[model samples]
Target chain A: MIDESRRVSMDIHYEISQHYFKEATYLQNWKLREWLSEMVDEEILYWMPIEENRLVKDRRPEPTPDDAAVYNDRYKHLKQRVEQIYTGQVWVEDPRSKIRYYVSNIEAFHTDVENEFAIRCNVLVLRHRRDTQIYQHSFLKEDLLRKTKAGFKVVRRKLTIDARSVQDKNLFFFM
Target chain B: MSDKDVAFISGAVRMYRERRGWYRSVCNVFMVGEKSRMEMRVMINVKELVDLENATQAKKIFWDQDIYDQEQERIFGRSWLFLTHDSLIPKNGDFVMSRMGEDKVIVSRQKDGSVEAFINSCSHRGNQVCHADSGNAKAFTCNYHGWVFGQNGDLVDVPLDTLCYHDNLKKAELGLRKVRVESYKGLIFGNMDPDAISLEEYLGDMCWFLDTILVGAGGGMELMGPPLRSVLDCNWKVPAENFVGDGYHVGWTHAAALQILGGPLAGLAGNRADMPYDDLGKQFTTRHGHGFGAINDAVTSIHPENEEYADFMAETRGVVAENLGTPREELYMSHWNCTIFPNCSFLYGTNTFKIWHPIGPGKIEVWTYTLVHKDLDIDVKRSIQRQAIRTFGTAGTLESDDGENMSTCTDSNRGFVTRKGRMNSTMGINREGRHPDFPGIVGASFIGETSYRGFYRFWAEIMDAPDWEAIKVQNDNWDEIWRGSEFWSDK
Candidate 1:
């Protein structure tokens, strides 16, 4: 008997980790179309909200999808973004930024829904571009995944980047 | 008399004098440069560097540290920098960390709803006093010596004053150096130089244009923050100039994104020759280096899905027409890429506000915010914000598309010979001139580099002028160069 809100079994945790790794692999290899089709749910809400630096004592509510966010994207929005990559006129990626994604500390918890699992993980991505410049991004990613007939699908993914100010030119690559 | 305590009074005066003298030196040092006034005047002949005749800028401006440093002294020092908006800090004690050139600043809203700013440095020892990006606080306490400053930046408390300094610390004189702040509509701006003109006057004729969006509808606009911040390897001016008036790059630089983007302007993918070279829209350049290039009737064009914004804009267009007039009504419907001299830029239609804070000559910290109408439906505002970031935020499709070009544009100048070369912006130079309806020097088409030259023209003036007084002298004849073309009279 799986209690809702309880941590999932080790087998379920391993299963979610494998699923996350595949999503990371699809992102790393520039297989965005496949990533979306195979790993993402049609009603997915991919979000990355603008987080302010506030004092520990300050209790203002955190930003929601209603506020300014880097990626408050729906399935259609994500599809459109992914479509631009395959357009071939994308000159910036022609030389191809060498990117490696590391997903770790993944934990799975049972959600209210029978097949759905609430997941949390840490993602560290390193990107090397042109000749010398390199960029690093660390994120605390909160995700909701569901076990479907076709395997696993990401229902939601909210990424909180660690750095207050991004050191890179842009966060173009998937995390 | 004998009761005067002569030694104590004299010692205090001497100490006060000593403190005053040290502060004067700190002011000169901290303000970037006042001691080396002549060096600023003769260091670089900006007229030579920014050639009005050629519409070319020296590549050195993008790569040289000396040129960049001079800009911090003249351009950033003299300029009215964008601070925060009223909507973001609705409550008192709300604050945000900002920058003026390289100097760190703390912008705070007081209990009286008045906004104030500071240099963010401690009065003693120069250690950073306020560390967080923003928060509610009664006072800021220095980590070093526990020196406490009030919400208005007045020094109020210090650690063990009697035990430490015999109770003689001058708290009144040692408050965090205040900056001159003024708000235009709901948008707040801070100036370092007290002698500089008011923010409204500094905006010049751009204020006339800004009012279309800022006040055309009933409630005007408010910015959503904290902003999307990222560092880009490019001169602050590069993006500033681009947004000021580089409509030419939209089709080419964002070709990939546009090919797939099903929008009104998607026909512009790859800068097609058939798109009417001179009929696209108009570019306007006002005094004080502020400028914009307007693309015709494409408000909310980027947000293809949210026709709610388009519908809301259509509804507001009538109100704007009634309140402001026909020109502004038409402006209300149009999309614009604009910059307020130096480094603040925004795309009106896209509603993406940006502050390009310079890190060095070839690098900048790009702070991005979403500007929304105060009266728009909450859903519409949310949709607009999403679309704004999707195209212009840190990982924006279009924004992602252009970062490489901006980086490479500055990177090429790293070479010795390359740094000495000239880069041309001479597109549609003859097509622009004065206009009857508009107050500024208006160009024939949006794609022209007419505004680019105008931007550089004022840039050179500000960089070379010794002070605001010197700049004020040339104000009457500032647009004399563009007036030579005489396009409006012929039209």
Candidate 2:
């Protein structure tokens, strides 16, 4: 179903995937400042709306920005979170927890905006803390990546977390 | 002075303080089990577990499975539990699945525009019906055996009813078990115990405090949902007690987040600043264990994005003063962290409504929603929702800090010696008493542990009382412990 105008070159697709992997590397290594300042667009919209379990027949529309969400972040919100971690008073993160990021299934398309690609990807995050505490999270992400002078910047990201009731103590970690 | 009766109070408690003998006098009421299970909780010698006099609770209360089972039946079964709010299920046939203890319930709006709830289990063979979190459906058809249940949990159809067994199924007797349902303001709650007091009565003086937020400016409040759900590995009571009156933990526990956000409460980070803490707030506890700690002029303390919410409070406080009077007006402009007895809790200023549903003694499932005034501008409501979720939702900055403390507090009791150990909440032992304007025990400061004492006081009372009848007898005398002191008058 690829339209001729929107299809991207294979070379561009490979570049975008590699860029996403590097972005994941910054987050997995807790280089949150670099992730924000380098990889994210200043006008980025990052959100994770609460997913409700409704019947297939239910016709209610998906949640908008006004509805409940786990993470509804602007650059400032993301910056505050990063600064919070760096404050050295975040005891929970101090007894440093281990984390790994798995990114795959990249499908990129050219959008109407010049140099902006609409991308869909799958992410699996694994976290382990304090001896036996282990949690796995999966998400399907829809992102808009802008090819700017600084390289690919995530302009917008909307993640659909797979868990109906998240099993972890908190989802404070980045996805 | 009402103040003349201050001799009975002490700042340090070395032994159980003597006041009213109501608890010790009720020995005859402590019977056990199938003489109506609500009539007794044999294993939980609540007197030893929750020592209100010393303000200490046994560590085992958080780890013991026997106590957890007793709670599942006695406390959970006999208490009014928070269910879905009407806003979430506004239309007829709209329903949401809820949990009361381990029991799954479907709360649905009926054809007559009233709400009804019933166990989600299929009446026959005990299979689960209606697995969706929420939906609009006339009937829930169980995949197994094709049994169908109506919106009110009435068993309507069965496969081969006429052909199989010649219609001996006795369909009328097999409706999913019904729970007594009631609404206070717009929030709906369910009670499994037939003998439990009406929801309004169960709410007790907590309603007086609730009116400050719920009915201030006349529109009342509603919970925004598709709530954020997550698991916390801690005793249900751990968080319950925290919200009840653990203001002590906030500055230290949430310091980083507060520092990053830099709101009015940022001064509280690390408890480093020696500010006028006592003058800032007060704590309150009702007859039925419901309680709150309210900080003066803190309505926008935690909200870094607090313009619209602050404006709403500024506009509404006068109207609330005109309607509910000056005392309530003060409450309207304050930040509050409260628990509605056994389980439900919320922060009014922060607007994060929560329910700590017990999974076992050492674990809980937390359901979070946004609480906002019904008639506010949609944009303002969304702003409050966003801020509330950002601070207290599953992925919240502050919530992450709390999860570790809660889990460790419960997990500590896993040690044999630790299980026998006792935890102290005697922060303001002699500091709270009756107030002329406030309807319950008003404490010296919001940071004090008075509400925790009051909370465990009722926990002991309920754990000992066999049924609501025994509870009713002492209802008039519930505040006997504070009967002699006059913090308001003396101060």
Candidate 3:
């Protein structure tokens, strides 16, 4: 009994929400290790502004690790970071012990392909560092969420804090 | 001799002898009294510092615990440290949290249109009262014990205070500890010491330099918050000193980044020999250690995509010339990488402002804000903010490039014996001297270390001054050290 437009909108919404829920659940359940091991085309293309305040030209070099050592170091560090979360490293979690990441205001757009849809959402993350203590509240993080077949992933997350200078204990939680 | 004269002479002699003695007696009574007096007598030398013109290694300004403690007392405690821009707290009851060294401070705009800052700790048991980074609030109630304080830092009410203290508790004594707050052209600064130098005097010649950007554009700038905060494993001084006048690093450290951007400065990557160096704008070092390295005619390069911003600066230059004269007018069009000594730094062209909050000897929390003209359209502000994040934010290409270097520099200096060796800052040694046109000492080129020398000169002065009184004596001698010919006279 649904109209064509309503039916199409509902279908798109369901598809986008399913992807988002899958990614959120994966991240919440600490499936980064499994995700990393998967053979899916996991290349991430990040485009940032150049010093000239414009989009980089074709001749402009791609964004890469600064040096070989830095690349190796960050790679190892990323692996270690994943492991620490899985192991419940108290230092990393202590500051963000209680956090609820709410991803909402989702909007879907078709990419170059019909099967693949680019999903965008507004995320608000709140953290209580310690139980019953309210001196330091984590700054709100605004991020851009994307959807893929594997799940919902952060394509570009921009953290817009409200203070001119952040007064948080530390930035240890993912937004 | 009279009894009073004898007592005075005896006390003076005892003090002098105790100071000279290799090992003074450690009696409990004498120790307590002597310790108290000794703490009071520890005078920091405000002048007479070793030259930093040849600094090669990273300086020990970051790792010295004694220096850190002294800075907390002398610099952070006494100076009018910058807090936030006025735009951040436009409405009454609007508040923002800031840091003075390690202590947290809450800056609020009151109903009377005056801004007030106070320690964030609760007056009752010293628990932090406000937890949010920034928000509009009529009152801040401590979460621990619900001790409520008004927007103006007055202890308005307490839960069951009549029942708890039975009217014995003094309300006046329990108010938040207030800090002296002032604003210069919309930039707010806080001071802990009542007798500290006025913000104008503390700024000194830096005001002339600041006016170039602050007062130049038809409308002054406002900070777009919240800031991008990230921890860097480096001494706070490294970044401050770098921004003060180290444009030399740009062509080298950011060569890869520049090549990626492919702007007008792309050819300068890898420091190509054909690149014009002398034609670049001159560098400057002021009496108060504020300095900048400016690139001539390249202001727009910092934000080329935003023609509105470039047009804004172009239009405002004439008004600034009328207000602040040609020196600052020229400065308005030039791309500047500058520092406001000790902690605050910003790029006028790039529109990125930062405060390096020291965590310890080898760590700092960098808070970055995008600066924009207050009168700019909302879309222009958004564009500027986007550009700022793409360049200076924690995940920005340039920021990441600099962060690794800063951390590595700090970590490498961890070798115990390596720290004893002094770093050299002597770039363009004997090349910088007094200039007629420029208000302060002028270096020949933007890459020169004239400002680094000036910064360390002040650093050493503060580190050495026996007390605040001693620092006052060197006010006259600040310009005497310069002995170079006036080069700016022709310009």
TM-score of chain A of each: 0.95, 0.95, 0.53
Stretches of model 2 off by over 4 angstroms after superposition: A1-7, B1-41
Task: List TM-scores for all candidates, in order.
Answer: 0.92, 0.93, 0.73
Count clashes in each candidate, considering only residues at least 3 apart in sequence or on different chains. 0, 0, 21
Residue range B1-491, candidate 2, lDDT tens digits: 24333322221111232212334335335533234533333535678898877889998888888788788877898999999888999988999989999899999999999988999888877888988999898998987898998888888999999998589989988888998999998899999999999999999888888888878899899999988999889999999999998888889999999898787888889887687888879999999999999989998777866687788788888899999999999998889999998999999888999999999888899999999889889988888888889889998989989999999999988898888899999988788998888898989889899999999999888776667766876766788888878667956
By TM-score, the best candidate is: 2
| Predicted complex 1: CAPRI docking category | medium
Give the best candidate by DockQ. 2
- Candidate 3 per-residue C-alpha lDDT over B156-264 given as tens digits, one digit per residue, 9 for 90 to 100: 8888889978988898888999999988888999989887777888888888777776766557778876666666668888889888888888876766556555567
- Runs in model 1 deviating more than 4 A are A1-5, B1-42
Q: Which stretches of candidate 3 lie over 4 Å from their true place?
A: A1-175, B1-59, B484-491
> Between candidates 1 and 2, which one is better according to lDDT?
2
Among all windows of 10 consecutive residues in model 3 chain B, the one with the lowest summed lDDT is B40-49
RMSD of 2: 5.5
lDDT of model number 3: 0.66
